[model samples]
Target: MSSERGETVAPDWPHPSLGNDLTPRVAAALAAAIDVPDFGTDVDATLAWAVATGADVATAPLAEAWQLLASTAFVDVGAARIIEPHLDALRILAEAQRDGVAADLSSLGADESSMWGVFAAEGSGMRLTARTSPGGWTISGTKPWCSLATSLTHALVTAWIDDDTRGLFAISLRGPDVVCHEGPWHARGLSQVVSAPIDLDGTRAVPVGGPGWYLSRRGFAEGGVSVAAAWWGAACALLVPLRHAARTERADQIALLHLGEVDAAMWSARASLMAAAEEFSHDGGDTLVASRVRTIVAHAAEQALRSSDHALGPAPLVGDAAHARRVADLGLYLRQHHGERDTARIGRDLVRGPASW
Candidate 1:
């Protein structure tokens, strides 16, 4: 993709400064770590580093958002993804404490740094079920798309309370009743994430929020936007090869055109996310804004992937380590975002018009 190192030098656009206290150093550290090509291979050590520097467990849920951004930019989505729900669980725990739900949160963040994946998808199929008696609650069933299921210390899962309702629960992943089925996953990209369907046989569980309330939690939309930020990071990262390719004459004129277009898409995605961030601060957990930004960024990511693939052809896809990983990683991660369905959902929400918040 490059013209022999110094054939023509590109004026690389700086990765986002984010202009937040946590992001500057965290981004720098992440940028440095990306150079290693396999920095997140050790999930625990990487998490420890993230916690030591950027993640403040005490002020969490959203406090670590910027750090998540930094890590995502560096293609550490698997690690960052695992940490996301743990922080959310802590936030939910805080809410539970305020609501007088009597459960112990003392076990968290004490023994070891935890990587938690949230298993909250309520889609039909082999769904998880919860049963309660005088003894306590027990959960049993399957959860799909469980990222880092085997590696994470814990999970916040969603299960059926009845035919019409669902509830969120916090549970340890290592329990004897829990079975993490690793064989079913066959993803080429983000295989590092280790997503698998979990089968639980009466695993003891602690409810995180009341039935039907998990999706309405304050951080639900915000956490989604945070994930959008991560996907946007991978989207932004896909451009380095394109940028470098654009700098030289040997790079085909057609290739240069593709790079320019992809750059625009990246910029547009960033701009939309910045708008959503503003909305988040003012309105608080605006699902409308979250969906809007996620769709816009995912659109950009789709365009970038297509343009880059057409522009660069096959060499970088297989030969360039960083470029290859970024393409595959961003491609797969962005799938976590639903394109037209989300766009329509937002459109449906707009029946009252933009005049109403």
Candidate 2:
């Protein structure tokens, strides 16, 4: 999912010197509107800002698109949590259209006003299935980890197309047959975005792609790395106070040491992503490229969390609402990486043979 472009459009808040562009303007607007602690409270307003800004992932260069996601996450992980999926859903839809796997976009009602969520996480004992009907397709059963299910207008859900394969389908969340179940999601971190289960009873849906196509597409891996880019931004958000503390005159040697190590890790992670973006821009998506970069960025984010705790102590975590929320948000968000499991996967890839490097 690489787009050739003439200029770079960096987001405004995190890096103003990157210059003025449509993405920067969107970033600036998001920065001003999103309140870190109270994020996800007003889904409509936040999504409205996004729709108004017209940030289409297909149009931007991969590097710039990732930068925008990272910058938004730097503001608030909750905002990133909302925006990233919307952007990913858009890209997924676009990929389906370009590959000629889906029908006209209008059939899915993919207009300017829609905010989408990607509901693909499967829970034990909960199986969502899709079947062909006279009225196109219908999805039934429950989908777990549907974040903001009640708030979002539409979602790209993955359901078992058959016993052997899963297919991606687009469904309107506001349908009468859809039921958003509350409770059971009581995590302190990222609590604002309630990821509850939703049950669909013969709800009509449009197939985005055939069985196995969603996971098989190149955009799947590339879209994953973009999520890691947001993770890196959230890590940067956590270290803001620590970086400031290390610069003060009374800064202790221990603070400086922690800051130095964390800074080095973050710098290396940033460089890795930049290099990955360059390669992806030229060669498109590769599983090895995505795996390597995600592992590096996830480790860097873990370092930020550990160093921020050790260097800053509990003061900010206890008193500063924004900082405390960022810490908690990042801590939970990093779990998406799968930690050592991801590392082991990368190791297996390396053991097989050398990558394109």
Candidate 3:
């Protein structure tokens, strides 16, 4: 399903891809708010600040800020993209001490991500379902591998009703109708990521836009861009340490060249991302540009990780030091949400179309 604008429709949601205008003010605010971590605990605090500030800012700037914050905070912004629309709800539910509500929505978002998880069964997809009733539609289904399931206030769960009609429901995770089952699966790389399972039996859900919403929207492409932004930040973080090592000659000359190559890749990735961001904001949504950005960021991340390992040698793996932790975290973050899959998709797009596509 593609939009009139030629953007592919996300699996099951409405709204064009994540749209954003990157005003200078918003970008400056985001850059200023992203603080380098002094300790492990600081990562969470920085992430909280980014999420809180991201709501009011323009989408492009927020995306940029999120990338920067994730780099310093060592959180998986890729996973965050899957759950972000509901962050506002989570914040509200958390403020009200409505754990059930927060858990419910978070689960919904997680379910959506899981449907696209690296291990998703072939041909299986998730959707958000909604219908009109006196009260509202009744939503029921299972969402697997929901990342950050415990942090959302609502989820856009897709469902089918009667043949030929699909529905998207913005179901509250906290309400009585929703049920979430925490998972046993965990990853060492992105430990902070809360991917879990959620069950909605008879949750009352509201409609999002209208029927066939996912087929008409470009939100997922925008999400791809967001993920790209975060990966860029992680690459940037790796560059800083690599730069220091190069300057001090802590590593051999060959290692220095590797760092330089990684730095050049990072700059290239950033340039691609900025170009995509501009196109997304100005032309509505362009899957070609978004895919290119995704590919660039993923390659940059891989290069940065490899270079960091080369520059720091076994120190990052052996020591429990901050640098080692950051390096490990970057590895984990890069693996989130099938980064390889995204890169492949971008490659496919590049081969099939012109650079401007």
Candidate 4:
């Protein structure tokens, strides 16, 4: 999509990973595959690509996470968002491997498989009830916003075992009686992710952790920033077109100004991520810092969306399939951050005291 009189096209401006300890094979592969539209790939095939390319990152060394950030940024964000949760599911499964988990999740790359972290969500919650049974446990009730609910082979789900207590279960979605209802998501963006509802009609599951363990884990909040990273990646994807137009579309001087602002915002977001990574590496965990990272990155993402749309105009969204989905996908994905509530929470944390700070 071109705006200037003679400029009939917008050149490709891909994300750059300079000396970031990022994966080489993954980066090259995603760059080549980016020509594909956001919703073009099926969920099962997407998972296969992610597993084959090491997109389902684990939280051991921070470098692996950064590599994931870079690669997903290079790929379609809708796919990135879907692949990341599966990675998180695998990470959790790895943690719960020794605790009587029957399924061999290590076969992620070997088969047509994908996992989901089916935890809490907005509006109607997953009232899933888990009960001790002859084989292991059975979950009843429904889980909401279950992304790839129908397509995924397995999921690390949250289920209530008692009135006030909830537990985590490693369940196979292919099991009998599990019905994945048609998607409740009608959003213009991330429709490819297909967040739907699933009813576990006495589906058997392998127990992972007890009540409160999910949120209480050391990586609970830290893992959240990874979502923010993906958000930042999508936002940065918007920049490539903006940067291209600013450099090529010389008639529009204001476009350069927009690029400048977005560059600064992206810089700040990246710095915050690196700083959070360093903090997590050194201090083990910092929920407060991670929350701040989410707020800052989300704010930058929102700003990038607005600024890029304003600067580059709607031609990209209207004409370019990849650009349109990137914009929409990012717009929807950034909603994971709680907006003003996050900023207020950060402020409250700062105002509270330095004792915990």
Q: Number of the top candidate by TM-score?
A: 2
Q: Scored by CA lDDT, what does every candidate get?
A: 0.67, 0.77, 0.51, 0.68
Report the error of model 4 at residue 94, Å: 2.5
Pick by TM-score: 2 or 3, better one: 2
Decide which is better by lDDT, 2 or 3.
2
Model 3 scores a C-alpha lDDT of: 0.51
lDDT of 3 by residue, 1-357 (tens): 112111111123221112344345445543454342322233344345545454544233434543433332323233333323333332222322322222233434533222221111112454323345786577666666665556544455556654576654556566666666566656555555556667667777654445664434543356556656666665565655566567783567876797789868877876777676667556656776676677777778888888778767785466534455556556776664476676677668767877675
If scored against the real structure, what TM-score would every candidate get?
0.84, 0.88, 0.69, 0.84
Off by over 4 Å in 3: 1-51, 58-132, 161-167, 337-357
Checking candidate 4 for backbone clashes, the offending pairs are: none
Q: Return whichever of 1 and 3 wins on lDDT.
A: 1
- Model 4: per-residue Cα lDDT over 1-357, one tens digit each: 113201312245445442364465555546544443322245665666555554334534664565475456545676677767766766655555434443544433224344565555524655788899667678899888788777677777777778877777777777668898776679888776788888889887766666667666666666688788788777777777777777783637688888988989988988888887877777766788888889888988898999978987878778777777777778888877878987888778877867354
Local accuracy of candidate 2 as per-residue lDDT tens digits, 201-315: 9988888878899988867788889889899877876556776788899899998898888878888888888888888877778898899999999999999889988998888
Writing each residue's lDDT as its tens digit, candidate 1 over 1-357 gives 123211211235444433344445455555544444345555665555544533344244342464456344545445455445555555555656666663553443323355556787755688998999997888998888787777776778898989988988877888788888775667776666777788899988887768876777655687677777777666666576777777777887787888889878877877777666666666667788788878887888899889889877898777765666667767887888877788888889898667334
Backbone clashes under 3 angstroms, per model:
0, 0, 26, 0
- In model 4, the runs with Cα more than 4 Å from the true position are 1-14, 18-21, 24-40, 54-56, 97-114, 350-357
Q: What TM-score does model 3 achieve against the real structure?
A: 0.69
Superposed by TM-score, candidate 2 places the C-alpha of residue 268 at a distance from the truth, in angstroms, of 0.9
Query: Over 4 Å off in model 2, which ranges?
Result: 1-41, 105-110
- Cα distance off (Å), candidate 4, residue 38: 7.2
